[model samples]
Target: MFVQNIRNICVVGAGQMGHQIGMLCALGGYETVIVDVNEDALKKADTLLQSIMEKWVTKGKISEDAKDAAFSRLQFKTDLEDAATNADLVIEAVVEKLDVKRELFAKLDKITPSHAILVSNSSTIVNSLIADVTNRADKVCNMHFFYPPLVMDCVEVVMSDKTSDETAQTTMNVCKQIGRTGVLLRKEISGFIANRILGALQREAVHLYESGIADYKDIDVICRKALNHPIGPFELMDLSGIDVGYFVMQQRYAETGDPQDKPAACIEEKVKAGHLGRKTGKGFYDYAKEGVKN
Candidate 1:
């Protein structure tokens, strides 16, 4: 019933997660509008999404006709008000800054219809922090999707104390409709589930690298070859953007004032240099070369 109510979906921020997530919703038969403040970002998202859909079609993951239908259902815009005014569900996939999200949520509350459910794609910060800025806290929740939403199957559906059951169930239903698995978290927690575990592993990996025990490349090789993990921590970081992890650490440290939660020196260096992983073409490993090695 809740799922049936969501027909027009608006995805805010056209960045790494937003574009692909909008594609998922469109593919799920929802009328999806992906909005971004920057025109260039929206243009880039359009090109990238087309390339992704083409790859999917070539790989037999989706048919060419299905791709055309998904694109037909998807639209891109630079104006938030125009994109979200009639939306039944709005997914905020902007930067990981708390103040930025709080401001956006407040604006969305005013722009969207009363029944619209607003969900954040934040990987670390819980929706509880952002929900308070809006009048309809009950309608705000976290729908955290992994990097490259088109590929990742799992989404963390986290609810704040004020979130209604209908909102959560509706989000989960949307996940199923988009062909992704949604794990519901009854309560809000920083980093949700996957990131909490991944954070711990990343912290240790950074520690091992900083401690001069081994090179980051060597550590990645060991994790992949020995532990049988598909991708190592460092490689995953590179793929997901080093600045993203840095921002998450900064947010965590600000929340807890934990010295341990501060961004590692290596991450800080990379972020400062603007080498923010796959998007920027240089991160833990340089992707400019033939093999994408450091």
Candidate 2:
């Protein structure tokens, strides 16, 4: 149903996930606009995209003409209403907080085109909770993409009870056209698929370390070399930002109210110290002066 009319894409937030997701939409030949009140953050996204696209050219993945064409499709707007004026789809990658998302979506509802599909890139918080805040709940769903959306192929297409079949299908179609491997979740649940499995692994990894069964580094090695993972659990946490995991766990704990449901003490401490994974230069391991592997 959404094959022809979809064109303009609006992304809210220019943070780590937001900018990359907007870039991917541009690569899909859509007229993409990243909306953020923070001009500095948007400028950073511009700089980051230029660097990433240049690397693509250097690797012979995309021609100069293709790179320029994709770059031409990228745009930015500081005002949410201005950006979503005629947007066919709106993907929000803002901070992973329920009230914050509800407030944003409520505002987006007033400004965006009625037909525009609103989706969130929240890792733990489900769209079911946020969709209700908008009158266009039928058009709202979750389109959770992996970290570094530039390289990752997966996109989770989640629908709440209010999400119409057409809306869900349209979201999946959008994913396919953008070169994403879309996984549909028929049932509404916390954490969807990937994060649920990942959370299970991380929980055990933390337990093993806390219980003195093994150090964090040793656990990472076993997951990497033995399990054939590109990066270990600890490394993944660092790359995706330790603070991100902390918030996710906080949401989950609120739902379950279990002590074990809370974020690990170690993860909480790292965030308090401002060692937020690769971005801050340290988390589970130090990355102040070396590559992620080091």
Candidate 3:
């Protein structure tokens, strides 16, 4: 279905990306329902949405009336079936795991209406594999949005072999309606475009850190000033969360079999210790102190 035809959109997952994505859709005037199995995660998503909207209001980027309208457009649910049953589109934004995502897709396929579009917001997983669980593969595709979906305009519209041209076109129209720039990829790839660039940088940064050439923060400074990049690799990595980075990189490395794709040994160690960046208050760098910690 096209944007004008689309009414209720169900977003599965209430984590960081999921919440932001749902908020963006609601702001665009879609009836949005964000679902998560975890009650705490659902509550957190609601709180995060409020915080983001409040920040925009404070910056005069959005009016109080706009914020009220956006909030009214959004809803939250803990049940999967309730969210998917009547949705015009169901977008899965849950954790990045093959089996977990596959299972959810299978469940959503069973519960969602036959015409409902099923999409994934995966950064590195193969779009085709994610479409495998559903019988309506023609309506299954990738709608990869960048970090902070509200601020970012670019969204990668990925089409797998089973993805229908109609579905792809409709998704593009939906992106336009939401005020996002949509780029099409004909085939499924591990990291798509943006993540592929990020993957390359991640591999090199890990290699640099592992080789004892420089500390994490030192490397971050060089990238920021010398390259005029907005955020240094190490600092960005920490903010992205070490566990999430390690998860994506490990899968990409395994898929590509590229030695450069492998994360540094320190990453595994840190993740094992639960130092998962800003959320944990510690990662490659200590967010609390605003610097790297060995």
Candidate 4:
């Protein structure tokens, strides 16, 4: 089915990405449902969305009427089956675990309509691994969004060998509809395009920091000043969450079994200490006294 024909979207897992994605869909005039098993996460998503809307209003980005219209189209649900019952598209944005994603898609396969497309928002885990779990392999692929989905305009529409061409194109169209630049990856890779580049930069950044040549703060400043990067490697990790960086690296390591693919010790240590950045507060730069080092 064409993306224009899709009216209802179900975004499973109301974490940082899922909720903003649903809001984007709603803003694009689609009936969107953000679902999560955890009630607290759902509540958090609701609060976050409200803050986003208010910020947009203050910035004159979205009119109050338009905000209300989008708000009307957005729905929050706890049940996957109920949220996906009549959805034309299902975007899974849970934790970045292959096994966890496989299990969810296995259940979603039975729940979603036959025509509905099932996509994953995995940062590194390719859809091919999770697509096999579902009966609709032809309709499944990866639709990865960057950190802070609401602000990031770029999205990756990735296709595996089993994915149909129509599915990939339709997903790309859906990205445009939601005001995102959809970069199509005809071939499936672990991190697709953006994250692969990001991973390479991060790997070297960690190597530079861990080698004791420079502190993380100096490294961040040098990158921003030299490379013209909007955010430094360490700051981006903090913004995206140290735990998320660790998991993505861990997943890539699991897939490639490469020593360099393993997450840096600093990332692992930060995650273990519950310093998950902005969410829990401290990461590379302390956010205890000042929140969100922007």
lDDT of 1 by residue, 65-122 (tens): 9999999999999999999999999999999999999999999999999999999999
| After superposition, candidate 3 runs with Cα above 4 Å error | 289-294
Could you tell me the C-alpha RMSD of candidate 4 in Å? Answer: 1.3
Candidate 4's C-alpha runs over 4 A off are 292-294
Candidates by TM-score, descending order: 4, 1, 2, 3
Relative to the true structure, how large is the alpha-carbon lDDT of every model?
0.93, 0.90, 0.85, 0.91
Candidate 2 error regions (>4 Å): 291-294
Q: TM-score for each prediction?
A: 0.97, 0.97, 0.95, 0.98
Worst 10 residues of 1 by lDDT: 285-294
Output the TM-score of candidate 1: 0.97
Tens-digit per-residue lDDT, 1-294, candidate 3: 666778989999988688988998898889999999899998888887898789999999999999999899899999999988999988889888778889999998899889999999988887788787789999999999887788889999999988999889888888887789999998888889898898778678778888899887888888898989999887777766788778887877778798767767888899899988777888776667655421
lDDT of 2 by residue, 177-220 (tens): 89999999878889989999999999999989889999999999
What is candidate 4's lDDT per residue for 87-202, written digit by digit as tens?
Answer: 99999999988889999999999988899999999998988999988888999999999878898999999999999999999999999999999998888888888888988999
Instruction: Provide the lowest-lDDT 10-residue window in model 3.
Output: 285-294
